[model samples]
Target: MTNELELKQWYQLLFGKIDSALLELKDYDGNYYWDSVDPNSLRYFVSNIVGTPWQNHMGLSLLSVTDRKLSPQSIYNLMSTINARLKNLFAAAELSEMVEFNYSVVEKYLTGSLMPDHTDRQRQSFLTAYGSFIFNVSKWITTQFTNEQQSYFSKFLFPKLPFDNRDFSVRTKALDVAKETRKTETSAVTPQLPEIRAESHFRWNQVHRLRKAMRDVLEKARHDRITLPLEFSYDESEYTNERWHFVLWDKESFGRYYKVGTSSENEVFLEFVRAENLDDGRPGDGLWFLEILRLRLIGIWDQEYLEDNERLKIVEYLNQWGYEDAVQGQAPFQIRNPGLLTQSVFIVRNSRKFDKLLINLEPIYVACTFARFALDIITSSGARMNELLQISYDKNCCIVTVDNSVTPPSKNYIYRLIPKGREEEENYYMPEEVYRFMSDIVNLLKESYNSSSIPEVEYSAATRKHLMSKKRYIFQYKGRHINEFTINAIIRFLLHGTIIQTSEGNQVVLKAHLLRHAFATHAVQTEKIPIDIVKSLLHQKDISVTEYYSAPTHQQISDTVG
Candidate 1:
């Protein structure tokens, strides 16, 4: 059990720490208490992002309130339900009500006031608030039924009371949210600052790997390691193999271009891109300009210049050109090179920026660790970091293994295990990285087939039944990014948090997944493993046509290691 007095002081410290950062937020404002770094500021954020996303989360949030005559009762219900539950939680025994409390939460929703996503600007606070709400609801009910059981004889030990009723309505609300969500950018309702940076970092790391691959190809070509050019051009006879390295383009003005591709019948099909003519703008353009300038750019470049509107303007320019009539004898902008077009557009609104963040090493540590020790017992032993979040260890493995029988199946499909006491991966140790994640969560395994750690409600009967024969790993949440889907998501809450101010007055806590990328990359590097091993470890393979989906063995990584 947590120390009551210490915990209270801790929460007070949390509140005081966040409260000091905001100028507009009153000390007792209810918004600050949730997970967002700065709640007050988040109420107003700059939503300059322009696009028609399939499902616009920010747009729906505004429309959810704007479209409906959502009474204060609706908001009150959101808050009260959250409030009542928080009040009853055992974990927050020392946590008392903050100011305006229920009314503040409900008031915005009740009055149909524009409520941007609290999570955007105030991630931690929003999560804190969201968690507090969930914690309060669950804890209170658990307390009333568990500790104060006799007094609540009116209901069964488990209340069939419609938790799903509210949950279901939230699903419907999303559809309604979709319809009511405005397509156009609105100054009236700005989004909160995006707070999911940790996740964003993980996505960006994949881009880093791709960048590295491009660099390797270019460097090899430059060194005359191959006869071909850096980026092998389809029209190498006419176009030198040209590549765009960042340093070359840093000082040069960059733009987009449109190309006319030939179809089977030689029909012209126009294609648009955020670059100059393929033949004209490769390495030579940037390199040529840099040579003339004779000056290397000083100071740190932002790495992602594409986000700058000056660069992104190329797209919009193309849009305008589509409507432009010949001003003189031809279009206003001339193609410096053959039949190619170039305009300026660097950033695609709502398009993700590839800013690499730190990838936490913990989870990768977990998967590799398990693979190392379990190799002797398994068919072929190599682990992917992904399986950590959604792996389910089969019952047959537990029968002989004997060590991990009582573990609860995951809410998601994450389960993994090896044969009892076997640890040889093609006669080598599995990567050490995965061991760490497993070491942290291995304690939950039980002696019986019955689940001891996981809650059955989180999963469906079909899933649970499957896990009855399998062991499951559970992450707090799971999702996917570019290239591939992430199967397992464990320990999402485990991270160092940072705070940033929002345009409104909210503060948000951001995590470190870019760091995790660094960690995963470094881990493979440390192990002296090959890029393919890294590729397998990261689950980025799409060679799904044959049986390439199966991860390679330790030997593969070992042989490929640089």
Candidate 2:
């Protein structure tokens, strides 16, 4: 029913817009053009073929062949129909690949109208052949298209695909297999909460020792016992000209010498100047400094001191002490802290003036204390790092409610946080001990700043925009909001040098988000809390997600059966 010129105009309009959008397209990690083989190529890959589950059987070439057989109007109709339906399913500020398409959407709009008389198996096969075409169109619309383009496509696209009223079966073997696989995979990957709980106690003991040593350094720096440009003499002949050095020492030696100094550029440069062979294994006097210094730097040091190119040099220096790829990996040094350095210190390799140099440890002490308190709160409350960082002091975010109905009065510590995916405020409950700890931290912040109340400032997460109205976050240092990187760095600091292995023999790398998983698992499996209640506590939209967190172990299943 369409004229030849009209069909040509539609093709030109649709392809032109798609090509324009593709020019600026990026993947979830901001890699240009999804890091495709050819950035300008419009080809798409279909990994799932109908009969072949193990190999990709089709690509854009197959779709091109199919297009050649169709009339121009039919091709335009097919493309427009798919685009129109997919636009309706698009969510704002979400990735195209992450959108979960329901069965009804896939069936009614995609495969159903095209093959009404075909069996479910036949329709699935048909979809297998053409699914890439639909996916590529959907990706273009959701990820690349502008609001104006989306509106035009939705409103002025071709007529809807014809639909039938016949009943379709809901249950399928593929769906059942997928559900079972998901459950099994989730259970296998979920860290055992009991192991984490036991390991946490040991880690905290190590942290306490490190904290005491840091305090000692701060006190000595204040009293002028430890002077900067600190030199360690070893034979005094073989002088190394490196400006910065990273020294690795045994854990017990960490408390003996915890010195750190900064440069004139306000950069904290840690070094252990040795004139003797490093393999000689003499007890290096200033050897134990870099371990704690690395942790402190990760937690508080400003990242602007080192350029991207300079990071390579720092990584190279760290590698000299057997810390290969330490800066690039999940170690504390990888974290980027936005907080400003309150005091600057640097190490001179072979400078003659060593006595006159003095580096203040007050900033390091404050940063260490902040990191400790933040970790305590995170472990106790099991809050998402961003949710905790965004807590507003001015908004009365924490509330205490007394339940007098019990034999002795009990108080509930409730905190209001704007959880991810939802804009409305949700209440998170904490223990009395955690509430008291939070109060002490608030007092410490107020006293440190010489103010009656904590300062209010805007805080934003790096990944997504937080929807909270109140911007005054309480977890800030020196007028800067503490970031997720800093919190994770604190975790790495606490667990440094200690290896905790999983059941699968893989080493455990502690992170702030992992603590969240530990919390959910403990609540559901250990505490015996009902799954639905745990779902409410986590503010999850679907019970299925909570189910994954609460999946029982093989041992638990065995015990139940027994």
Candidate 3:
């Protein structure tokens, strides 16, 4: 028997603040709703009833009854019975058993007498909500019990509710009744390439415009057309500290400024920049500022405008600012190749300066490039976003295998990826175009680093238990590997202003995972590939999952019905 004191504690935890005969409930938004639910009565409404105000109220009014009323022991016994019935239903091997349990056990607590005036739909809704509430409560109650006590209440130990609280028979019956309705309803379609292509073009165009604006600003600064406070020169008359205010680009009405100075000023500048760029919501304006700053310093050094002492002072400042490779006589850019200027030596050397920098353009630039490359790979190969992001250069991530058995020699481009939730690596087939793209990116990285092979760094994959030391990850910027958040941000930034409407006329938000879905849909629907083949390509364990991607759209449904 369950202890009365413990049951009372559990009751308090489950339902908060029951004053008099009223039971107080809080919605997700923290708003309270009081119902005429009697805690002392033999009958009690089910806990955690969710729906609209009226629906919840109605559901709560329909009580779960037993011979003995409102004691902790009686309530516990009723909940245990419900838990046992649910376990039996979930564990039933045959559909007949499930159907029998539904009628015998489920309908017992949620009897027709409780809602005599309500329709069949209303009764069914209450039944569904009651089952869910009991299941959740049972799970919670099990957590409070000891291991031995849990074993005694075996049903609550691992309570598995059927999908959507509907058994096979219920689903079959529902489908039979709604067959005509489903015919009229349009199934969801995966994202199309044309829409994604348009969005990609928009993003690239924005990047180009930003680059051009940056160059124009740099040219003006170089020629002394506009004065930029690149150095720390205090203005005593104006009572202003030495600061660098970089104006990269500006709209007709409002201008975008990147301010690099003290920590306090950077905070204020960031808010200002956010306000200025609030229209598009694009990130990395601070990164653009840093890039332009690096470029201007290089231009100044190359032009020999500053005297010996002035140049030495600039070098000292660069060293202090955490540019580790900044030598006494050499220019900041000349310390390393311009392409390699934004490497770890520049960014991660000083932790304080890095934090104040707000963002890095190199990572954003690298993320953008990888995202572009990944768009082709994901759409073509049906690779998961994480699988592509976790590819390591040291592991021979991409390989070309030739088949001699065929009449003509065929080359297969295989990308080895650690699939999500699996420790063992899997091979993903790719097109020659994708292979060439990967090669080009690899070559570019090698060139930038001025090395024969891509530099090896420590990488940690989501599936792995430990960090992979000395692995050259292809999807990396500087010393850091680009993450899903950065990639998603870049996708959103690129898709800005490019509108793709849904069948219901709502605007569609593009994501990287949606591209994988698009690839699957295109393979099965557009290419007329076999379901098994599509499933294999998508690396899906179940064929049914793959079929979901190829579901007919509204237009297809309309045409078929016509």
Candidate 3 deviant stretches above 4 angstroms: 1-191, 205-364, 403-410, 439-470, 560-562
Q: Over the stretch 58-83, how does candidate 3's per-residue lDDT look in tens digits?
A: 22222322111233333434344443
Residue 520 CA displacement from its true place in model 3, Å: 1.5
Tens-digit per-residue lDDT, 37-126, candidate 2: 221122212111212211111222223323234332333334343333343433321224312444545555344453354345444333
Q: RMSD of model 2, in Å? A: 15.4
* Cand. 2 Cα-lDDT: 0.47
Task: For model 3, state the Cα shift of residue 415 in Å.
Answer: 0.7
Q: Which stretches of candidate 2 lie over 4 Å from their true place?
A: 1-332, 340-381, 447-450, 462-466, 554-562
Candidates, ranked, TM-score: 2, 3, 1
Output the TM-score of candidate 2: 0.49
Q: In candidate 3, how many Å is residue 549 off?
A: 2.1
